[model samples]
Target: MNKPLIAGLLTLALAGCASSQPDQPFSLTVAHINDTHSHFDPSDVQLTLNNKTVYTRVGGHPRLLSYANQLHQQAAQTEQPFLLLHAGDAWQGSGYFKLNEGAMNVDLLNQLPLDAMVLGNHEFDLNNQRLSDFIDGVTFPIVAANLDVSQDSDLQAVENLTPYVLYAFKGDKKKRVNSVEDAGKYPVVAIMGLVLEDMANIAPNIGQAQFKQELVSAQQTVDTLTEQGVKHIIALTHLGLDKDQQLAEQVNGIDVIVGGHSHSLLGDFSQLGWEKNAPYAQQFTNPDGLGISCVVQAGKFAQAMGELTVNFTLDGQVTDCKGTNTLLVDKVFYNDVRRADKHRLTDTEQERITGFLAKQPNVALVDEDPGLRTYIDETYRPELLQTYGAVIGHVPSSLQHVRVPVANQGSQVAPLVAASQLYWANTPEVRGVSGREVDFALVAAGAVRNNIEAGELKAGHVGLDILPFVNAVSLVSLTGREVAGLLLETINGAIGDDTHAGQFPYVSGLRYTFNETRRGHGYLANIEYLHQGEWQRIIPDARYQVVLTGYHASGNDGWHTLFEAQQAETDRIDLAYVQDELTAFLVSRLSKNEQGAIEVHYQKQALDCQLPGVSCNADAQAFIDYVQARRPILTALPESGVTVNRLH
Candidate 1:
């Protein structure tokens, strides 16, 4: 738990010239990005500057490449060893990947000058065959030392995919370039991939692949490389930042760890109105207590790059690790893009905002690489346009998502997402399979993605933006006590620390209050189920059918209680893909586009003005109710049931 050394300008170089002794520290710049998630094009970001919230686009693969190329050139000119690495999850979450799958990710990621990349859990989303094709397709090495792919022949046959890669920066550049050469002439850095050890639950379609324990694999790899005369070692990992810290604390001889999968943005973004976040390029003490291991990860969705200059002693201990988590953004700014407002920011305002931004070293105004942008627009975007062009639904306001939210509302979208699962489960076709009506639905906070703006929600947006993972909805039978336990654990995970917050639960037809000061199951209180327009307290022994995704059912993320409940039961039925249900929920239940509710007078004869204090939000009240059995009024957003009384 030592204070991490980062967010600084490096002022010193190697103790003189590069030498083979512990006296002269080896200084190298390691540039990294993680959880890119197929964002080849820029995405919208809202920033606050000079007391105004301005909308601007930020972070694309093209822009990321453009910056990395510049860094690479700068390092080359100085003869400093520079390595650009991706810590996995370059697939899913965009239309490009939806249509092309791993094919598109391979094509675009291959374009980057990536030295090494680990395998993220999403890489196994399409099973081993497709993942094998992607690995073979990529030009760079795919490193995952702990992944046992020997049982799967297709993955086993991939040439460039290996446990670790050795880089001989001081060796002859022209000799056996991609692999090692002249090993005796210079010390080398061994970069190995260490992925999440559990495979069955996270990626069920993993197909004959098994992952060894992360710490064991890391220690073994470090030992093997050390025996081979390698002084420097880096573990390119898909484990989240918390896990990375754990790895740093548990192991010895690892100089650095580049990590992904948590979608965590480190460093300060107070200038952009973002609350304080985790520190970037944090350092942890190795198990030996004498060595320093620096752990760094770039923010998710290619939004930023992590640049760490590690000064390592000849014995492989890090002397200094200093760097910045730079946010990549465009120069354009606006008041709001949702209303298609173009001229909201005046010239004076723009100048003032620009002046404020110029002072922050972490914020950079840059342009995309022209070639990559053109390819994205011409080759990939048109197909996505054809696939997801039509508008399916309209929103009243922007629904923001936070994996761990504060105050009364846990998340704006996760509850809605859970409601969708419940709706999909009760569909006649699915209910027939289950042989019973589902009582409620559940979704992990991680399962919901994207801050849906107040505008048209398109057909393509459902799969490509939110709920991008491939998971099927299932009906699981659980006692009320079991349900309470499941929710408490997920809340505790989110509240405990900076790790595994993605497991926070959002449920439909149920309400619960959380107290931060309490311990174990006592953290939750007033647990109730919405039954026939009444909130009834849950009975401990009563059986209820819960609808959720296969991932939750498998005990992935932090929903281990559900997995244990499943293990004890025999009556569980899988209904449909979670995204399909989410899409239906938006279109059928939430949208007001089809036959306006005011026009149809759907809510009530008195214009549905029931709550005395609150005015009827027009857009909220005016949603289409085309489906039968839609009993309760659609627009009345249920008062937030999950209230946080004492969260820090």
Candidate 2:
């Protein structure tokens, strides 16, 4: 890890050397924004200055550009060198960025005087080459220590980019009486980038061109910069707060690590000091040799800006520092260009969003319904309509519990998901295009987020509760023997062998059965695989195409065998895509049946068991209680601290 020192020593050499002046004390400002996601509309801004009633639009290139300019002016007046930095995940998310493929945000970012940019996982969603192209259009140097972009076609030139950068400012020097007054090089502000290894696991498809490991790569970057005498080190890290804390523990000499990814709005800017004498030196409140390492991450979006002032000396060392994380709000008036009459709601959404922002509480009094404007703008605002593809159906009943499958039909959970996958794979235009039809689909009952409700929820709520997190459908190629092995593992892990074998699939396209004591795995006796309409023995070496969400494929919830055996590769279909497909399938089913109900049924198997001295029910209940009580560790969140129920 102690590598990459060769390039850190030299960054810039001026053509003309001015005589070195007396060492003077000066201030420098390091400012940054994260997760803007192209909400450039004036409506996104909010302000809460003390007793100042202001209803101003927020979060667009124009507004941000203006704020940046103001900061630059303030820096000049205060004799502090100012530097602008972005932590990461800046290019994707909102309507505008999606519509124009990040052009608007890119244009806006370049318009501001940004010194450096850090690469986030989302930036790779367009694939490595396009990501490189996007980076090329930016004026600042992009820094990421763990991303190996050398192999990418568009980013090869930028691979050799130093993980840390030093910016030096030349300013007038304050002199003591009779002391030689000397102009000083700009305060050297050091920038470094770090990303979590799991970032690859979570955003696999987008991050295929890169690899991430936070601690090791970050330490190397820091050591190199510290050796080069960079005064203040700022980590523009996209690895989230916990990972940032871990980095602070393991590495030393870094002054500040600005973080992102986990959007936490802590409400203020504060410093965390690692203790010098604590057993875990890294997490200590104060470290013996190192000055406190200040870590800050403003909540996501342009919701806030983090400002830190580091006081240092002529020899490149920090003396003392204090600052605040400021919440930026609109303080002026803008015209309402969001009227639906101006253009089609969808067509003018992105532009209109700027005009529709809600008047934040305690800020100003421009409009009462600030949220409505945000909603309208977001739904229609993005220049592109790419977010519409993914939709999923919701069922009211909890699907977690199992029951008997219908005489002629199969498990409802199985079939419903199967139908969705089939629909996703073979649409009117996509059927048999690549000689691959999702022959089989698999979903663990545990993967279902919750019972879909009968009534509708907010679009965001549905996305959050049903889909929860982002996951794509991964197509994995597996042999029948491998499939059988997976099934055997499942059976062994289940309550008992008497439980049905097909139960594990929680899917409808295929079926199989097993007996507990009568047969070994029941594969030799009742094992059967169904496809189309007939029975087929799952050939061990015969390759079968299977579909599963990306989470399982990545072994997120204990699916290591599937990951290893099936050779899973995410097909790049996010959960939103599955949600959309489900919605379409439900609609189609509703139209065909006319009843408008998508019902899924599962067969509950009755297992025969004997406890030497206890009733089966009582024995099972006791055992459950024992296990629940003895569980080594638990982390469960309760809705409330107290509960009340009517007694019968």
Name the best candidate (by TM-score).
1
Residue-level lDDT of model 2, residues 19-98, one tens digit each, is 24326665667777776655555432212233222233434444555556666668767755677778888866554554
Please report, in order, the local distance difference test score of every candidate based on alpha carbons: 0.71, 0.48
Count clashing residue pairs in model 1.
0
Candidate 1 residue-wise lDDT, 1-648, digit = tens: 011121122112221224342334577789999999888887666687757777777789899988888787687678677788999999877778879988988878877888889999989888788998899888778999998878887677778789998765541121112222333344467789999987665765788788999999999998887776677789999999889999999988899998998877888888787747788888899988898888888888798988988887756668889998888888767765443656457788877877888789888777899988888898888998887666656554456677665656557666666766677566675555556788887788887766664445565676567766646455667898998888888888876644577888877888888788843323775799888889899999999888777567657777777655644333555433232222111101111236532111112222222434323221111111111135221122465456767633
Q: Which stretches of candidate 1 lie over 4 Å from their true place?
A: 1-24, 170-181, 184-187, 314-316, 339-341, 391-409, 418-456, 467-505, 508-510, 514-524, 527-639, 643-648
Best by lDDT: 1
TM-score of 2: 0.51
